[model samples]
Structure formats: structure tokens, C-alpha cells
Target: MTAPARYPVTVQFGEVNGEPATWAIETLPEALAAVPLGDHGVFIVGAVDPDAFDESDVSVLELLAANAVAAMDAADRRRRLRTYEDALKNVDDMVCVLDGDGAVTYATGPFVSWIGADDLGDVAGRPLDALVDEADAPRVADAVAALTDAATEAGGAPEPTRTVDLTADRDSDRRSRHGELRLSRLSDHGAGVVGSLSDTTDLRRTRTELSAERDRFRRLFDRIPDPVIEVVLEPEETVIDGANPAFEAQFGVDETTLRGRTIDALDIHDDRLGDP
Candidate 1:
């Protein structure tokens, strides 16, 4: 007895003895057509009788593959753009995009609420300088004008960006808010500018309080009756940075001359009264 041939098979339409018949194909026939999706896989559409495939079939398959890849690329771009927009909307900082003429194009995030605006449209289509405090408006305009001139000189290349600390006036309450504004050219062709505003009102207030406290401490230190000296520790020795007036009188040295001198330089020993 002979062993039966074991081969992978696929069903195909055919005719046997002038009657319709189905037969198993061991391998892909010459008339079979297939299209490959790049890096994905191949699609076998159908198989025909031998010699039925032509050059047109190959062209059609190539065109289909190209179109499929292009469609996939477009979809990917849309997905990424959506993700970026979502992140911008949810961020805590205030972000705005401007047009080439300095009109506001888009604004988003917590800054809208701080400005007491019902929506982004409240500030949109307005000049960026309009929101700045009057005292700072001229400075901001000058900086932007300089940047624009530089971009022109460079044949439309983007100019270096700038950050300015300024105060903004809110429309709703007319309240002044301290913020740091960062400006950057958006395109190589001088298309527009993007601005990011960071609120620093609370931080500036805290810093002011700390500075006043430091000044108060310095005044009290100067008025104290006890002699006091401030020294800086170094690898070789301790150097006196400053000394109070009482310290100067006790040591019989001018406070200015004593500064920057090592503490060991002021050697003192009991000599006039012996053991007293």
C-alpha cells in the first residue's frame, strides 16, 4: 500500500468531465492575486484559471497598498493631534496662541477663570498688549517689536523668545494680577507668536513679606547693646565679615579694617592686671 500525500490544501472552483467540480489546491496557482499591507500582512483575494492573471492585476494591487498606507498615516496624525489638544486643555498654566498680526487666536486653562471670562472667546481676537498693565504695555510692545525686526533681518527665521514679568488687569473686576509672560515665535516664516502666562501673585507677595522681615532683623541687630561679630567659616580659618560698633570699641579696631581678617589675627592675652 502507498502512503497518501499530505499537503496543505485550499478549495478552488473547477470543472471535471464538463460538470461543475471543486478541487483542493496544494499550492498557490499562477492566477492567484494578493495584496500586502505594509508590515501588517498579505490578503489573498481569489484564484483564477492558469494564465488568467495580467499586468493590470499587479498595478491594481500596488495602488491599493499605497492608498491603504496613506489612510493609516492620516489616521495616526489625527489621533496624536487630539491627544495634544486634550493635554493643553487640562493643563494648569495659561496658554495662548496668537496670529501673525498679534491678535489672540486661542486661549485655554485656568487663566480664563482667573480673568473672570465666561469663555475663551472673551479674550480671543484681542491684542495681547491690551491685557497688560498700562505701565508695562510700552515695554512689552518694544520687546515684541524688536523681536519682529530681528526675524525680518534673518529672512523670516524665528527670533529668540523672551520672558517678561508684568502685571495684568482683569476685565471683570479690574483687579491687577502679577504674572510672568513668555513669548516665542511660532514659525520660521514669522507666522505668529505663542504666549504662556504663569501666575506669580502669591509668590511675589510672600517674597515681599520675607524681605521686610529680614530688614527688621538687621535693624535690631545693629541697635543691640551687646558686641556682636559675624564670621564666615573657611577651610583655613574663620574670617570676620562684619562687627557691631560695640565690638569695634572693645577691640580698639575700626570695624571696616577688622572685616576680611582671620579671627586668630586678634590675639588677646591678660597682661596689664596679671591674674586679676
Candidate 2:
């Protein structure tokens, strides 16, 4: 393998052997002629006719240098952007990109983890609605279409953001994930739309669990054997929705009187019912 390069080098305009019009540069002759430099050691001069020096020559050199710098800058910028994009693709969550027409341009990660085999493999350039559940697909499609329309109509400013759920196939398994889909205008070109998607299955699962827990509590309150009572205002009466067999035997009161009866008239002084 070739050895590493040495220290850095600097170049700038300077006198070429005391001849102001005799243009030359200072640099190693073997290094690169494409780069403006004087000579191989210290500084050197290149012979150019004095009459050739003109405003046009200066402008040409300036343009050449500017073009070179711009090319180099563009190359570096592209390299960095590619590196960042690769990193994003490797992320754990499913990521999908969509165009202005709601067609998927790219898909990565385990989309099937939440959505089972929905034929997501040949997904490139396919509309997102196909992979989504029928119930939720139209809602999400309308939202995305609206975003694209607004983006086109919205002179320069970016369109407002929106989030929606979507489905996809992953590894022969059909899964349903809470996908957060975002719609944004891609730069100033206005040629297409760029979409970003993230999986939120865990959040949805947690919400479902909370709903189940609330239902469980309601069931317990309504079906328990204890003589649970509820008080009502306005008429000031008590309602008995739940009671055990022992409640009637111990209180010596019929079920009818126990329900919708004014508590003050019952005169329940027994420590068995409450602490009297």
C-alpha cells in the first residue's frame, strides 16, 4: 500500500520572479499543475506573455477557481448526506418514505413486526393505502392528500404537520403498528412530497390496557356481593344497586325498602351495616 501523505500545503498569488505580468505559482512541480502553484521548491515562475494579461484572463482564473471550489464542496456535501441517510435506514423502527401522490418511495426496518404479511416486499412506488387496514386507510389517505394539496398551494411555507396510523408486512408476518406518518414539502423544488413514518405499537398497547382496567373496575363496582349504596341529591334518597343475602337477614328490611329509601328514616343504628 502507498504511504500516507505529509503535512498540508497553502497557495496564493505572488510575484513570479519580479515580473508582475509574467504569471506563475509557487508549488512542487510534481505535486499537481491543475492546482495553481509557483514551482517545485520555495517558489518558481512560469513564463506567460505580458500582453496576454487582461481583465478577461483574471476573470477566467477567478471563475475556474470558484468552479473548482464549488465542485469540491458539492462532493463533500453529498458524501455526508449519504452517510446520514444510511444511518437512518439502520434504525430499529420501521421507516417509509412517500411521494406527493401517497406512493411509497422507500421502506426499511421491520414493518412486519406490527403488521403481518401484507405483501409489502414489492413496496417501492406503491400507494400507501394498499398496505394499510381498510378501516384506517381512507382516513390516512385523505389526510395525506390534503397535506400534498396544501403543500402545492402553500406558496413557500411548509405545510402543517399531521400524524396517522398505517399497516405493513414484515417478514411474512402481518402486523399492525401505530405508525406516525408525517407529510412535509421536500425543499423548494415542489416536485414531490417526502414522508416519514415511525412505529408506536407499544403506546397503543398501553392505551388498550388502560381502557381494559377501567372496564374491570366498573364491573367490580356493579357486580360485587357487598351491599354497595349510592346517594342521590335533589330528592335526597339512597339507591341500592348491589347487595348480598346476608344484608337482608341482618338488616331485617325487605329488598324494596332498602332500594330508593331515605337513609335518615331507616334509623340503621347497627354496627353490622356501618359503625352505626
Candidate 3:
């Protein structure tokens, strides 16, 4: 076989000749009929006979190519889905497919492990809301109901996708896991809901710790005895954002009113302000 050539269409053409040629040929074929199979490459058939290839032959090839493309497309989709499932298996997040009634039709391996289930069958057919913490169950239900209502209002059109943060009730020692639940309608007709629950427990804890740290710093800063003022450094000059209680008492002006007012606007004697 020869390398595929791109002309009117991509194809690989070759011929087998012998002392007693079984297949009689008047001329060497230039191109062969072919069909693309996505990333799997092209499927090439017998070489085209320019003289014998008529409109009827063209129709046959077209039909065959159409079927081949469809099959290839389906196979490609399954391959991609397998790859996605494999990736999700190792991830901390859980992927799930829900039916119209919000029942779990399919779930990733992580979900099964998190729930302490032997397999997907343990969770399958269960209401998705049951897996959520009792505190978050109502919120999850409301979100799903709203999507369903919106789809109905739109005359069966797909509802807009939305994401919500909720806690999942796990059977493991973890007990509960904070997750961001991304919910979306699977089809244009709103046939079902597809969602992914990404574990955000660590992220939420980090944010909470950072917030507490910030509050501690603010308390310490405000309690300091020295006259302290926060200023915004500008290209032309500096503007006061706020001043502590000591500075406020010395200046005889409230920090709120002093804010946004430039230091130059203040009455200073003996160039004391220049010392800073």
C-alpha cells in the first residue's frame, strides 16, 4: 500500500499485479474511496475505477461512508468517556448522573468509597438529596426543583446551569465533606441532571483560618497604644485612610472624617509631620 494522498479526498491507493492477473485492469487507479474515522484515522476501501465508477457506485460509497462515520463517532465518544471516568476515579471529586426524578443513575468510584458503599449499586437508584447533609438537603432539593420549574416554564427547553456549595454526608470517619456541586441539565429537553461534587473541605478550612487570622491582626492593630495611621501612597501625595484611637485623640478628628483627606490638608507646626 502507498502513503495516503490528499487530493479530492484523502486515500491510499495501490495495486497487485501478477503473471496471471485475476482482477483485470485497464489503467492504474489514482485514488481510492475512503471514510474518516476521527482520531482513529481513515478507512480506505478498493481503488476507484474512474470508468466503471458510476453514480450508483458513488451512492453506495456515500452510504457506507455515512455509516462508518457514525460508528466511528460513537466509538470515539465511548473512548473519551472511558478516559474521563478513569481520571475521575483517582480524583477526590465525585461525578454523578441523575435521572429526571433526581435519582442517582451513575456515580464515580470516589463517590462509592466516600459513602462506604461496596459498589455503585449501593447508591444507584437512591435519591441524590439523601446523600447530602440534612442541613443542606432542603437547599439541594430547592435548587433541583428550581431547575425543573425553569425548564417547564421554558416549554421543555433546557434550564440554565448553576452551582452550589453544600456538605455531603459521608459514612466514613470524615462524616461530612464540603463540596461545590455543579448542576446542569443533560439534554435540550431537560431529560436529566448531571453534576459533579468536588471536595472543598480543605479550601473552606483554609479560608476560615485566614479570616480568623485577619480578625486577630485587626484587634491587635486597634489595641496598640501608639499613634498609628494608615495612609494611601499616591504619586503626588499621601492620603490618610484611617487613624487609631491615639492618633484620632491627638488630631481631635474622627478617623471616618479624616479618611481620604491628604496629610498636607492637616495643620502641622514645626515640620513634625515631615519626620515620617
Please state the error at residue 137 of candidate 3 in Å. 0.9
Candidate 2 runs further than 4 Å off: 1-87, 112-121, 149-158, 167-178, 188-194, 223-275
The TM-score, computed over Cα atoms with residue i paired to residue i, of candidate 2 is: 0.43
Q: Write the per-residue lDDT of candidate 2 for residues 170-229, one digit (tens) a residue.
A: 444644456776655443332234556676678878989999997887677556676544
* Cα RMSD for predicted model 2: 14.0
**Residue 105 error, candidate 3, Å:** 0.6
Number of clashing residue pairs, candidate 2: 17
State, as a TM-score between 0 and 1, how close model 1 is to the true structure: 0.57
Q: Please provide the root mean square deviation of candidate 3 (C-alpha atoms, Å).
A: 9.5
- Candidate 1 has an lDDT of 0.69
The positional error of residue 168 in candidate 3, measured at the CA in angstroms, is 3.5
Residue ranges of candidate 3 with Cα displaced over 4 Å: 1-93, 115-118, 149-158, 169-175, 231-241, 260-276
Model 3 Cα lDDT, one tens digit per residue, 226-258: 778888999999999878897776656788888
In terms of lDDT, model 3 sits at 0.69
The TM-score of candidate 3 is 0.57
TM-score of each: 0.57, 0.43, 0.57
Candidate 1 lDDT over 1-276, as tens digits, reads 232355445444778889768656565544667788765567565554686667898788878887886676556544553554576777767877665556666778576665446788787887666756778777666556545545566576445687878876666866567888888765333345667888899899889899999789778767777768888999989998888776666556787888999998875555522353
Query: What's the C-alpha lDDT at position 121 in model 2?
Result: 64
